[model samples]
Target: MEVRHKQATIDKLTHENATLKRLKFAAGREHFNAEQRRLLEDTLDADLQAVAWWC
Candidate 1:
């Protein structure tokens, strides 16, 4: 891929990661339960890993 395209992909994934972090934090506010929060966090982590591998 072109350098510009690669950079854009990286930026987009970074944005997604930030968004997921926000979502996880927002979810944490109400349901402080262990399982739910852990799942959300795990999802976010998987997303981040996928992005990293893709880039």
Candidate 2:
């Protein structure tokens, strides 16, 4: 039981780390001006919030 719990935790952390890395890579893929960056960030925030709400 203890080993199973540890493995589950590891899996969750690994998934979250991968998600963050992907988000970072996507955000860095393009260069934006300050205004565009703010808009992009706002859009990402809204999308993330929607995802969290669903989760």
Candidate 3:
């Protein structure tokens, strides 16, 4: 039982680490120029604000 619990914990942590790595890769700015990145950020900010306001 103890071994199963530890293995479960390790598996969960490994999955979380892999998810974080994928998110980090996707969020990297290397694919965008500065202007494009700025535009995307501005659009995202506006969308977030709209969501907040709706909420």
Clashes of each: 0, 0, 0
Please report the TM-score between candidate 2 and the true structure: 0.50
Q: Give the alpha carbon lDDT tens digit for every residue of 1-55 in model 1.
A: 5898789777878788687767768775756578876887797788777777876
Order the candidates by TM-score, highest first: 1, 2, 3
User: TM-score of model 1 relative to the true fold?
Assistant: 0.52
lDDT tens per residue, model 3, 1-55 = 8788677666655665575466469776446668976886686566556544543
* lDDT winner: 1
lDDT of each: 0.76, 0.66, 0.63
Q: Which residue segments of model 1 deviate by more than 4 Å?
A: 1-15, 21-29
**Of 1 and 3, the candidate ranking higher by lDDT:** 1
Off by over 4 Å in 3: 29-55
Per-candidate TM vs. native? 0.52, 0.50, 0.49
Write candidate 2's Cα lDDT for 1-55 as tens digits.
8788677666655665675577679766856689976876687667566545644
